[model samples]
Target: MIEIKNLSKIYKDEFLYRNFNCAFEENKVNVILGSSGSGKTTLFRMMLGLEKYEAGQILGFNHKKIAVVFQEDRLVEWMNVYDNVAFVLKSSVEKQEMDKLINKALELVELIDYVNYSVKDLSGGMQRRVVLARAIVCRDSILFMDEPFKGLDDELRLRIITRLKVHWRENRTTVFLITHSQQEGMLLGDIIYKLAEKPVKFYKI
Candidate 1:
């Protein structure tokens, strides 16, 4: 589990969180729902140790590998689907092992057929799937997704959601997802947190 105790953050004299406390359960899909600029992303960054807080303690995250899919695809335009996923692991794993991991991830996302296709040529939905594949292939202890389903239509979003549910069931990795959609929260979250101005509220689904 991850715990946030007495958390406080400020930016340009605007307070994001103050004395906020929350806990994300282990091996579950935890969703944080908030509007844009409501400090959902900031909280995620704090938990990932990418941002510093004024005063707080985030426990159970140190030394744990993390996988992330930001709002942007962040894929290398020149790289094909397979290479983009492989790029994340190429520096650490051998060729054969890298190939296996990449293949497995693509297969899980149902994009194995497009493994050689350039990301620039793929549709928006396909690119999103590639991004998800890359994150899942890392095999990290925790996964973070920031508005991952943005820009896609409802049909595609639902398809990707189905894939994610299966992936979580198989891997059982701790997941933290930030989004603004209530439908998405109901679909993907095991525990849903609603963030507002100062205090944050949450409920189990």
Candidate 2:
């Protein structure tokens, strides 16, 4: 389990989170649902150690491998789809193993045919798939995603989500996803956490 105990964060003298606490189940999809400015991104940033909080203890992540799909695609525009995913893997991984892993991820995201295409040439939705493929290729790492399907059409989005559910079940990678859509929360989350108001409160559904 991952625990956030007595967390406190103040931004510009405004309490974004105050004495907040929550725990996420391991090897499960923990989807966070919140409106804009409800501290969803802030919580993710703090958990990823990209942001600092005034006081808190985010436990159970020590030395664990972590992978993220940020609000932005954050891909290397010049790199091809396969290379982009491969880029995140350790150099110790053999070429054969790397090829197997990258191909599997691309297949899961329905981007296998675009493997050699540069990210800049792909559509926004496709780029997002590349980002997801990258994260999932890190088989043992926890996955954190923020609006991962923002640009995809509904049909493709649902297809990918189904594939991801299967992938997650097989890999047992703990997932933390933040989305505003109730459909997305219901579809992807094993446990849904709703965040609201100042000093955000969690309503587990």
Candidate 3:
């Protein structure tokens, strides 16, 4: 379980949050819903320790082996799909297990055929899937995704959502999905958190 207590961030004149509290369980997806500039992305960055907050406590998590899909597709331009998935991993997984994991992850995103293709050659949605593959294959208990399906069409979005739902259900991985779409959040999240101008406001669905 992940516990966030009194997590607050202040930048310049803006207060991202203050006395915020939330709990992410071990085997479910939780989403933070807010409009752009609502500091939703910053919250995730702070949780991942990518950015620091003014005051807060994050417990039961380590910096190592935590997989994330940042707001951008931080894929290496030159690396192919398979290698990119392997890139996030620190330890050298055995060949057989690594192969199986990679294959399953790629299959989840429907990118198995493009495993060897350079990420730059793939479309934005496809590249996003590669990043998804990397996060899913990390085998982490916690997965953080920021606006992961922003650009895809409905059909593509539905397909990826379907695939992700299965893996997330089976793995029982703790997931944090940040997005503007309440519909998207409703599809996979067991609970949804809505953020207002600063701290958390309310959540339903």
Candidate 4:
């Protein structure tokens, strides 16, 4: 389990979190539902060490590898889908093994056909899938997803979510997903928490 204890964050003289506490179950899909301006993304950034808090301790991730799929599709526009996904992998990984991993991840996102296509030429939704594939191939200890399904249509989103569920089940990767959609929270979350208002706190559902 991962615990956030006595977390406090103040941004521009306003408090985002004050003594906020929460625990996330290991190998589970931990969903955080929060509306705009509720600081959910900030919380993720803090936990990922991209943002700093005034005081707190995030336990159980000391030496673990982490992967993130931000709201933006942060892909290399000049690179093809396969190369973009391969960028995060270590050089020591065998070429055949790396190719296998990339292919499986692309298949999960239903982007196997676009392997050689440049991300700059793909649609927004397709690019997002490329980003997802990159994260999936990492096989990281923890995965942070902040509205990862933004560009995809409802049907595609649902399909990818189902595939992701199977992937997570097989990999046993701890996941923290931040979204405001109730349907998304219900469908994907193994442990759900509602978060809103100032001085952040989470209410488990």
In candidate 2, the residue pairs with backbone N, CA or C atoms under 3 Å apart (3 or more residues apart, or in different chains) clash, namely none
Q: Tens-digit lDDT track for model 2 on 4-58?
A: 9999999989888999999899999999999988889999999989999999799
Instruction: Please estimate how well model 3 matches the true structure, expressed as its whole-model Cα lDDT.
Output: 0.83
Order the candidates by TM-score, highest first — what do you get?
2, 4, 3, 1
Q: Candidate 3: lDDT of 89?
A: 64
Give per-residue CA lDDT, model 1, range 1-205, as digits (tens): 7898898898878667778888889899999998877788888888878999899899988888888988889999999999999878977899998888888788777799999999999998889889988987887889999998877788867877887778786888899999999899989888898887554444444
Model 2: per-residue Cα lDDT at residue 3: 98
> What tens-digit string does per-residue lDDT give for candidate 4 at 66-98?
889999887878899999999989664789999
Query: Across residues 1-205, which tens digit of lDDT does each residue of candidate 3 receive?
Result: 6889887778776766888888776678888888988888878888888898888798878663566788788889998898889886648688788888999989888899999999999999899888888988878778889998867889978888988988899887888899999889888888888887545544555
- Candidate 2 TM-score to native: 0.96
- lDDT of each candidate versus the true structure: 0.85, 0.90, 0.83, 0.90
**Residue pairs with clashing backbones, model 3:** none
Question: lDDT, candidate 1, residue 198?
Answer: 56
How high is each candidate's TM-score? 0.89, 0.96, 0.90, 0.96
Off by over 4 Å in 2: none
Model 1 lDDT-worst window of ten: 196-205
Cα error of candidate 3 at position 112, Å: 1.3
